[model samples]
Structure formats: structure tokens, C-alpha cells
Target chain A: MSNEHTAGPHSVGRRLIDLVPHIVLIVGVLIFAFPIYVTLIGSTWDAATIGRGSLPMTPGGEAWTNYSQAWSESHGERASYTPVRLMLMNSLIMALSIAVGKIAISILSAYAVAFFRFPLRMVFFWMIFITLMLPVEVRIIPTYKVVADLGMIDSYAGLAIPLIASATATLLFRQFFLTIPDELVEAAKIDGAGPLRFFFDILLPLSKTNIAALFVILFIYGWNQYLWPLLVTNSADMETIVIGITKMIGTGEAANDWNLIMATTVMAMLPPVAVVVFMQRWFIKGLVDSEK
Target chain B: MQRRVIFDNKLLPYLLLAPQVAVTLIFFIWPASQAVWQSVHIQDAFGLRSEFVWFENFTAILSDPNYVGTLRITAVFSLSVAVLSMAVALLLAALADAKIKGAAVYKTLLIWPYALAPAVAAVLWMFIFNPEIGSLGRLLNAMGYNWDYRLNGDQALTMVILAASWKQVSYNFIFFLAGLQAIPRSVLEAANIDGAGPVRRFWTITFPLLSPTTFFLLVVDMVYAFCETFGTIHALTHGGPGKATETLIFRVYQDGVVNNDLGASSAQSVLLMVILIVLTTIQFRFVERKVHYS
Candidate 1:
């Protein structure tokens, strides 16, 4: 390391080498942020400005008007319009339900698979694991049929439950459970703690970090879901913000409210991106660990 | 990996496993089996009766030139997305890996796009390349470039690819950063001592060392492009401009939902399932080998 400091001949090249990373990274960051910047700027402008096809790079005075229109009134395009607020609430419910539902179900299942001696345990585990291959897109028709038969359509249950059954979550929990020291379990047994007691007390507390990490991923996963929600909910009130924003756009660009649509886009992305940015460490940890 | 000290409750484990097992059975296994069964059978157009016709639907789909074209489109789309996203992410990750100030800021800014839904991502990109209201779109059109994704098939495909790759690059960036950071700094320093430039050191040392991560990301990204990009395609193109951007999964949605051909859709679903199984199996094998080696 010290040898490089004595070299005056290579100083210019080394300085250039140091500058290269900053230059490329700045360009990369700008490109990554450009769409977001454009959308954010578009959200504040009036529809007519956007409708006239003039690119408004600067913020407009219609921030309140555009946001209020997007949030309150259902534009006349669709017969029934869902208020963006209701859709946001619906998205929040669906995402939170999915995240909590998956964590609850998967933890118990992973507990059983990891800690209990039971018949067909591997069968149950493999059955859960096989779901990974059969993504809803592959089996969506039949899955929709099943949900319809269960009379869950147009309900929050329909939107969240089928998607909540997560193999990745179960696998993650199971892997974490396996790494728990056996002596802890033996000590729990000696303490006269039953399975449920140990699970609710010791095991749950031990899994706090994993649960938090998984929550970030699962919540984002739930919030970002488009097709499932699109398929299950035919009604306006049941529409998620993600689906509603797309529906607002319609097919052609002529009738669509560009300002309002961009506003809704910003609203739709807010919660999930906030989750990722706030819980970034956990999200990254969960992602890397789960992929492992 | 069985636990030495295990719970010995007979009914309790079943009780614990009930929710996941039941959901899996109803939502995943049953539907998947139904897809398989429906693929092997043909239903009448009247939605009344069906007959067992083993391999007939598969044969029909194989014989269909449109289906073959879809397969090719999917291959091209998936490969392009994977390559473009990975290359871009790898470059950004490498740049970030260099000793730079505010690297943390760079990473934080780069990764949040991972949280954007594919549909939302498509909508964001659509705003920019809308060929009318989009700034870039308006710029291109003003310059006499006939640019309408809704009208141009190739343009539509490009739009969808860019959107999909945009959404995915963050994921690959995170992984690549991890892989690069895991490389021993000492090794790179030693290479520098041996007269290797940065490019040579990266290719010979950093890249080879990062292959495991790269391989894993390749499989993951391919699968992502196949399945997850459905939202992007559905929102941006809807298999648009005469089915130019239709991937397999989107085709499955179009056929089953819009066209109402249950049997054919199920056949397509089954084919997708097979492809995924193969990809996943290869991934698992490589992962297991990596685990053993480590």
C-alpha cells in the first residue's frame, strides 16, 4: 500500500481511475432515478398540460388539485370509479394481511417440520416446497376456480389468502429453525415447557429478527402483486391501488388523465418503497438469506 | 438435519401444519393437478363435456406456429432482460465497489426500485415513453421518428423489455455488490502488485470469483423475466401490436381468461411448469454443490 504513494509517474492515471467510479455511478443513479423524477414531477402538473403533450419538466401549481382529484373523485372513464384512498386502504389491508398471514402460517409449519417428529412430515414439507414451481401464473385458472368455489372472490380473503401461502417464507423459517441450538430445546423440555409454550415464548422471541426481515420482503411482495388482485377483484371497491392505476389509464392515451394517473402511481408506490427504504437493512438481509 | 430433541405430540404437528398444508393443497397442488389433468383432456366449445385426449393438446400447441413464435419471443425477451439487467447491474455494482465516498447513498438510491411492482414500473416507464405525453416519446416524435408502442410492435417489445429490465436491475445489483464485496481485497491488491490493471484483475479474478453469484442470479433473473414480467407486459403492451410482446405466461393469461380456452391454457401452463421445474432443478443442483464446496 505504501509503495503506491511514492510513484509520481502513475499519479495522474491513479487519479483518473479514482474518478471513473464516481462518474459512472452518478450516471447510473441518475438513470435509475429519472423515471421516478419524471413521474413525480408529472403528478403535480395539471391534466391539460400533460394532455397537450408538452413535457413539463418543472413542477406545476396543481399539486393539490391533481392529488385531490386522484384521491377523491373517480374519473368518468369507468362506470364505477374507486377512490384512490379506498384503493390505498385496500392495498394496505391486502399487503399487511399477506405479510402477517404468511408469517403466522409459515412459522408454525416450519416449527412442525423442524422440531416435531411426525408422520408424512417430509411429505408435507415437499408438498409446500412443490408450490414454488407452480406459480399462480402457471395454475391461475384452476386457482381462480378454487377461490371462486370457496366463495372468496371480491373479498379481501380472495385477494390475500391464496397469495399468502408462501413456500419461500416457510423455507426461510425452516432454515432458521434448523440453526437453533438443540440444547435450547432440551432445556425447554426440562423446564416442563410444552411445544406451544416453547414456541410462543422462546422460539418466537428468538425469531424476532428473522420475522422482521421476512416481513419487509413479504409486505413488498404483497403490495407489488398486480395480476392476482387484478384477477380476483372485479368490483371497484375491491380494486387495489396498483390495479386501479392501470385501469385508470385505459387502452388509449386520449381519454386517460395523465396527471391523475401519475399521481396515483406515486401513491401506489409510496408505501412499498417506504418499507424498502426504511427497513433496508432487513430487506437486504432477508433477500440475500432467502436466496441462499 | 433432523433434530435430536424433538417434540413427540401426535396431533400437534398436524395441527401446526394444517394452515400451510391446507392452503398448499387447495391453492397450489389441486390447481396444479387440475392444470395437468385439463392439459391431457379436451373440452367441447359448449363448456359441457370433456374427453381424455392424452398429448393431443400438447401436439396442437406444438403444431401451432403462433405458439412457436411465442416460445421464441419468450426466449428472446427473457435472455435480453437477463443479459441487459445483469450487465448493467454488474457494472454499477463494480463502480460502487470501488473506494468511493457516499457509496452508501448510491446503493440506497439504487435498490428501492426493487420495491416497485412490475405493473407500477411499466406504468412509470409508460409515462416516459408514451409516444405522446412522455417527454422522451414526444421528443422522438417531434424528431420525425414514428414512435408509438401501441402502433409499433418492435417499439412495444422494446418498451416492455426496458421496463422489465429496469425493475430487475436493482435485484441483480444487490447480489452483485454482495459478491464483489465478498472477494478478498488482498487478492486484488496482490494482483495489482503483479502488474495487473483493473480490467484485467476484474476479468481474471473478480469476475471468475463472482461466477457463483452470477450463475445464481442468471437462473433467478431468467425465471423472473418469464413469470414476473407478466405484470409489465400486461400493463404496458397487453401482448400488444399484434402479439409481438406476448411471453408464455402472458399468453397463458390471454388464452385462459380472455379467450376462454381452458384446455389450451392449461397445456401452456403445464409446459411453463416443466420449464420452471428444469430451471429450478438445475439451480438447486448448483446451489447444493456450492453449499458443499463452501
Candidate 2:
């Protein structure tokens, strides 16, 4: 690949042609970044500046005021005043719990299916695999009813538990486990290790990269959940930042604080975006591998 | 695909499987069955009385004009998003695959939007397109476009579609880029040595090879538009200008949660499940075919 580019004498026309990709990519990047740029600038201004039409492209003097207010106070005039701080905390907890819970349960289930000969193993595998077809939105009402019946609504368990069962994670782990050599199991047995001990010392250590990659994907998924959290949490204290930001917009633009909402939107995007950017290699691997 | 040497304990496997199986039954399998059951029953609004009316809810939903409209809207919305996002991502991916400088930096910048929540994506676009305060919205109004998505159905649908597609591009970009990268340079170089131009070579060589990835992404993008874009629609338009942007999933939510029309909602849920099942089957079949080819 590198030799092809270096083998030829560089012509002026060829040099110009080589520049096309860079120019196109820059334009693409700018267009993609435009919305976030606008929102960031808007978050720094007072509501009056934003509301008066023609939002300034430059940052204003109200950054501290807007962020502080959005962080501590209610946003919409008519809506419930769920502080962004609490909502961020709720979102954090929900994302972490869902990521960790899904990984833990899925690894166990995958280990069982891959390493053990048990009754109804295929049935259990099929049962878990079939869930890839049933998204939360499709079964919203009945799922809501189940949670309500269990008296789990408005709680963290309600927020995360129903969502923690993941077909993708299970399948990923199962696929990974199958690729492990049989010699490891024999070695563990020769060392007088029990099933749990082998799993802890051998399998768990081997699965670290897969687990981290899956964590990045699941964390974003859990954080971005809107409808499930919307249905289950009736109280303001339990509101996720994603749902909270929308509620801040409310029904009308006139009664809302645009700057505060913008600040919250920026804050809402920060963690997940940071995770993807920082853990990009794992995120990409998990996304591509999970689909396969 | 089991291990050669394995754990023989029956109780340990079940115990290990207990948590996942329990959650799947309680949350997934049970609610799914309930959706099926509720679909066949007509319940009064108050949860007071109910009657088993098999196939009646399905018949009514199928006959309802609003449901039909929603079905059309969903098809249009899903296809538009899939095509638009995939096209843009493919173009960008092709360019990024061109051995250009700063490709890694450009990729990092582009793929970060995959992490943005759909609802947050909606908020960002809504801020830009908000009629009174939004910069672009104000510009449109200034140009006598009368661009208020709040009052205009077409404008609302367009806005919702753009926002949804925007959020989805990074995801498609990552997959497309990977797909493009996966293609062997030897194939393209062979075509190049044959005096075939870049465009002809791309169409004849690159596209056919990329079809499996394209097909996979098509299903994924469609599924995304169908169900996952609920937050985008809910936040941006709330399926309004009088149900203009109401996709099938939003209608289910509207009927079930917002309106408390349980019977209709459950019927819709059942139908949606069937649609998703069909989509999943198609995806799996294609995946299996691809695996065999490889």
C-alpha cells in the first residue's frame, strides 16, 4: 500500500488530486461539528440573546451563570424542576449498573453454555438469543406493567435491571469463549482447580479486553436510553439527563430557558462522547464484532 | 460449538444461568407474552373490566387509517434515513480510505457523534432550527421560507429525519470505514494495472465487494430508524403537526402510555414485534450467507 504511493514520480496534477480527500474530509468534519458548535456557543449566552433571534456564533459572558443555574435549578417554567446535577448522577448510575450487570450475567451465561454440558442448555441459549429481536420499545407497555407489578418503578433497579439482560453481550462472550483452546481447561483440571476457580483465574483474565470493549458499547447504550427511563420514572428526582433535557424544552419555546437547556444538552453529551473518544479503539471493535 | 474438555456439573451450569434466565423470563419473555395476550384482549380504560376478543385488535389496527398512515410514515422515514446516512457515510469513508494524511484524526472527530444520545441530537438540531431563536430557522424566515417546524408537517418530518440521520451517520461511518478498509488493496491494484480508471474500478470492484457490508448496514440503519429514532421524534416533533411524523413505534407509545389505550397499543406492539422478527431473520440469513462466502 505504501510502496504504490512512493513508486511514482509526483506530478502536479497528481498532487492536486491527492488533496481532494483532505478537502472533502475537512468539509465533512465541519458540517458534522456545526450543530455541536452552535449549541456550545448558545450555552454561553443569556436567554435574551438566544431568544432575540439570530444566535451569535461567538461565546458570550453568561457561561458560568447558565451552567450554574442549569446545574442547580429547574429549567422549564411549567415543568418539574429536576436539577441537572441529580439527573447526571442518575444517568451515571444507570449506565454503570447496566454495563456491569450485563457483562457479569452474560459472561456467566456464556460460560455455562460454552463450557458445561447441562440439561436444557440449547433451550437456554435459544431463549437468550431470541431476545435480540425484542427491543424495549417494542414491548414498552407490558414491560412497564411488569415493573409496576414488581413495585420497581421510580427506583434505580427499575431503571437498569430490565435493561441489563443483553443478547449481544452473551453472544459476544460465547463466541470468544469458543475460540479459547481446550488445553487451558485441561491445565486448570491438572492444577486441581474447581470450575469457579478456573473461571476466576483463567477465563476472567482472558476476557478482560472483550469485557472492556463491551463496557464501552453498553455504557453508551445505557446512557442514551430514553423511552424506558421515561416510562419507568414518574418522579423528577429519578429523571435521566437525556429525558430531563427534553422536558426542559417542554411544550413551548417562550416559557423555557434556552441557555440553561443548551448547557444541559452539552453536559448530557459530554460523558458518552468523552468515553467514545477516549476508548475509541475498543468502541469500534465492540461495535463491529458485536454485529458479527 | 462447545469446548472439548468441559465442566460436567449440572447444578453449576443452571446456577450460573439462573440470573440471565430469570431476567430474560421476567423482563423479556414474560412481557412479550403479555403483549401477545393483551393484543387479543380488549380492556376498558379504567383497568376495571376486560374481555377476550381474539384477532379483533389486530383487525382494527390493520383497518385503522391512522395506523396505515403511520405505517407509510415509518417506511418512508426508515428508508430515507438509511439511504441518506449510508450514502454520506460511504462517501466520507471512501475518501478517508484514500490514504490521506490526518485520516485518524478525521475519523476520531467523525465517529464521536455515535455516542451522542438521539434525544440530545434532537436538542442540538432543534436549537439550530428553532423558529424564533434558532439561527438557521431565523435565516429561513428571513428568506420568506416561513420555516416553522412546529406548525408545518412537512417541515417537521424533514427536521426529524435530518436530526435522526445526523445522529446515525457516525455509526454508519464507522461500519462503512471498516468495510472499506477490509477490502484488499490487491484487487484495486489489479484493476488499476488493467488501465481501468478509478471511478470504473470503484463501481466494478469496490462496490460489489462492499455489498455485504452495505446490505448489513441497510438492515441496521432501517432498524435504527424504525425503533431507535423514537427519542429524536419525541423530542423534536412529538410525532406532530397532527400525526404527520408519527412512526409505528411512536404510535404505540402514544396509544399505550400517553393515551392509556392498552388494547390498541398492545396490538401495535405485537405487529412491531413481527416486523422486527422479520428484519432480524433477514439480517441473520444475510450474515450466514456472508459467512459461507468468506
Candidate 3:
């Protein structure tokens, strides 16, 4: 360990010192994952077992029964809306639309801001970026009025339109675009390529990484949104998964069903957790790039 | 041709700004103006034919006794959540930055809560806090501790704060990690060469370098604490255990969503917005200048 004291980036034994923190990190991950692990385990249990918090990893009864109960409550003693299919579809619709639409607009807008020598270029750029300050919380009431007035509430358009144009996306693209050499644009100009042509031809190919990164972030955000959807959608048909899960546990007095509620909550969480694990590389890269 | 040329450049600028301006006007500008308009005029939001009764609602809000308590509770809740979340986030960021092996796994797992729709986080916390079968309850019971958030005001405040801070830590951690990594690696290596001990290096070099990130985080965290905690508040406590966990945004939600008192809610909303704007301006103007980018 002392052999490379004066050397540059030394040996194998020294690397273990760097790894000391990682051992702690593994424990930290377990602590963080405890709630999620509990959610999954609890969901698998029947009502009687879940309340005890003594449910084993594998339940005695059918595993698919909880899944079915969480998905369709009518099959059980109660014949009513459990918010299974309707909310799932609504959330997916809202999230997918936001992802595709925001990314679509971001690509064009970011591409325009990056490749062109347009007038008010910097001013226009900042104008879009400043929307970051307009927290949705601040604007929720008024935005609701606008959505209502537009006759868009409870519809897919209301859920998606206001969020499609993202300041963060534009800023990220502008930052990435800064790294591209101007010589390429100049050469494209000499090759009789218009600004549009230059963007589609020269710039688009170079931005695959950025596009991938942006989609993952925007997708997660769109998927996880709760408040705006809850506010806009009044119809049981239009409720999101999160809202459905909340409604399932309505008021403490009505004999709150722990089994169905936990089961549904787990179902609501699966896709986003999968997104976090799978898209993490792109997620971290996207964040790091924006910081730069 | 010359006459057409005059307006062309000017028109292009507006054309570029048109979509953004349109959406802003539709969503933000109009809503803000409506918020202000509703503040002064007294009217039923859900009912027909709202009449303009100037200053009526504002006076009603100020005089309301419960509102006074609500405001005090809100100020305390939001401020505490901000400070506590920032502190916890800074610690997590430091731990994550220690270049630990599975820190990425920790980072991802910790941040998963942030992605759980605030609504779901609220529901999840409520289940965990359930006295009979909640994990926290069972754990506390096992330890011979009687932790009842429903009957205890102080405990309710503590419980809500813990939940809010838990959700918020990841929000701040991401920013802090970015800020910590932004501190040039070469400079830190230089400090190491000078024989700076771990504690000394952290206090003298790392903390100072991370200040900009910390400051940026403070502002962002404060805003999140103020505005974004509403869904959690609504789901978990509903300003319960005798108004112990009520916050500004929670109060607004109570007024608008529950009481359906549009007028009072609008006034509270306006006041909240004013405080945030003033804080944001000070943050950008004064606090931002003190940060050393290098």
C-alpha cells in the first residue's frame, strides 16, 4: 500500500481504499429500498396478513389473485369501481403523449435555436428558458381555468398540451449545440443547404445521445405527474393510476381495505421503477450534460 | 421590396416567439391575472353570476381565526421542511460524492421516491404511519414507544416533516451531486498534494466549492417546500391532528379544493406567490453573486 506513495494513480491495494465508501453505499441502497420492498411484499399478501406486517415473502394463496383484485375489484365481494383499468390507460395516455409531443417540439425548437443565425436568437432562447421559473403550482388555478375554457379538461389535450413545450429541453439542446463546430454549418451553407437542411442533415445525426437522454427524463416526469391530472379530470373514466389508488382508500371509517390498496399502489409504481433502472445511464448523462 | 423588407425582420422575431407567448398567455398570464381579479372580487366559483365585491374576500381571509393559525403553521412547516430537506440532501450528496462503489445504486433507489407521484407518496406514507399495522407503528410499538401522529400535534408535525423531507431529499440530492462534481477535480488533487487532511480538505476546499450548488439548492428546495408539498399534505394529514401539519400550499388546497372557497384560496395563493417572488429575486441578485463558479 505504501509502495506507490509518490507515484501517479497507483496500484491494486490502493484501489480498495476508494472502494471503502462503496461498501457503505450498498447498505445505504438497502435502506433506501426498504419502503419499495415493503410495498411489493405487502401487495402480495391478503388483508389479514398485511395488517400484521408479518407476511412472508411468498404468500400461501394464489399470487395472481392480488393482481386480479388490484386490477378489478368487482370480482371480490364489492361490485364497484376500483380504478384499475381506466386509470392505467389514462396515465399511460397522458404520459406517452407528453413524452412524444414534448420531445417532438423540443427537437425542432432546440434544433432551430442551435443551427440558425436568426434574429433575436439569444433573447428568444432565454424567453423559452424563463418558463422554468413559472412553477406549475403557481399557475395551477389559472391554468385550470384556461383548460376549462378551452373545453380541454378531462380530455387528452388538456393533460398534455400545456406541458409539451419544455424550457429544460431547450436549454439542454442549446448547451449541447454549443459543442458542435460552426465549420459544419458553414460548409453546409456552401453546399447550398438551407438552415432547415443543415439542421436535419448535419445537426440531427450528432444529437442522438441528447435526444435519448431528453426522452427518458420527460417520460418519467410525465408518467409520475399527479396534481395536474387530478385537478383536470373529474370523470371516473379520466382518472390516473395515482388518483385511483387514492380513491380506493377513501375515508378511514369505511373499513379501509389494505390488501387492494397496496396491490394497486404496487401496480402504479412498476413502470416508473423500471424506467428508473433501465434509463438511468441516459438519465445521469442528461443531468450531467445540462450541468455543464 | 424595400417596404416589405422593413417589417420582415421584426415579424420573424415575433413569429419565433408566438407559440411560447401564446401558451404563456393562455396558461400563465391569464391565470395569474385571473388570480388577482378573483382576490379583490367576491364571488362563488362554482355558482352562476359572480358579482364584484371589492376587498370583501381579502378582509374575510385576514379576519378568519383559523386562517391566522393556518398561516403560522404554514410558515413553520414550509421553513422547517426547506431547512431540514436541504441539510439531509447535502449529507446524502456528500456521501454519494465520496466515490463509493454502489453510490449509483443508492442514488437511484433514493431518488425513486421523488418519482413516485406526490399523491402516491402521500398514500404510501399514510399506510406506513397507520397505527395498527403501519411499519413505523409496528417498529415503534416493538421498541415500547407509543407514536400516535393522529392524537399528537407535535408528533404529527414531526411525522409530516419527516415524510415531506424524505420525498424532497432526492430532489435536492441530484442538484447537489451536480454541483459537487462541478468543482474542478484538478483543484482538489492540488489540495491533496498540499497534505490537506480529509476534514480539513472538506471544510476548506469542498464546502466552499459546493456553496453555489448549495445556494441554488436552497432556493429550489424552498420553492418545492412552499408549493409542491400540497398533494402530500392533502393525502397524508389533510392538515390534521388539529392543524399541526397545515402549510401555505396545503391551506390553499383546503380552501380551493375542499371548502370550495375560490375567493379565499385565490387571496392565499396570491400572498404565497408574492413571498416566493421576493425570495427568488433576492436569491438570484444577492445570493447568486456570492457563488464562485470556478
**What TM-score would every model get versus the actual structure?**
0.97, 0.97, 0.85
Ranking the candidates on lDDT from highest down gives 2, 1, 3
lDDT of 1 by residue, A1-292 (tens): 6776776437888778788888888898898899999999988887778777785788888788878877888573333357899999999999999999999999999999999988898999898888887778778899999999999999999999998788888999999998988999999999999999999999999999999999999899899887799899998889999899888887847546787888889999999999999999999999998887
* Pairs clashing within candidate 2: none
Candidate order, DockQ descending: 2, 1, 3
When just chain B is superposed on the true chain B, each candidate scores a TM-score of: 0.98, 0.97, 0.83
Q: What does DockQ come to for candidate 2?
A: 0.85
Model 2, B80-149: lDDT tens per residue? 9999999999889888888778899999989999999988898888888888888888889999988999
Best by lDDT: 2
lDDT of 2 by residue, A1-292 (tens): 5655764538676788788788889998998899999999989987777878757788899899888888987554344458889999999999999999999999999999999997799999999999999999999999999999999999999999999898999999999999988888898898999999999999999999999999999999999999999999999899999998888888647546888888899999999999999999999999998999
Model 3 C-alpha lDDT per residue in residues A86-146, reported as the tens digit of each score: 6788888888888777766666666556554556667666656556666667656767778
Stretches of model 2 off by over 4 angstroms after superposition: A1-9, A74-80, A252-255, B44-49
lDDT of candidate model 2 versus the reference: 0.91
Off by over 4 Å in 1: A1-13, A76-80
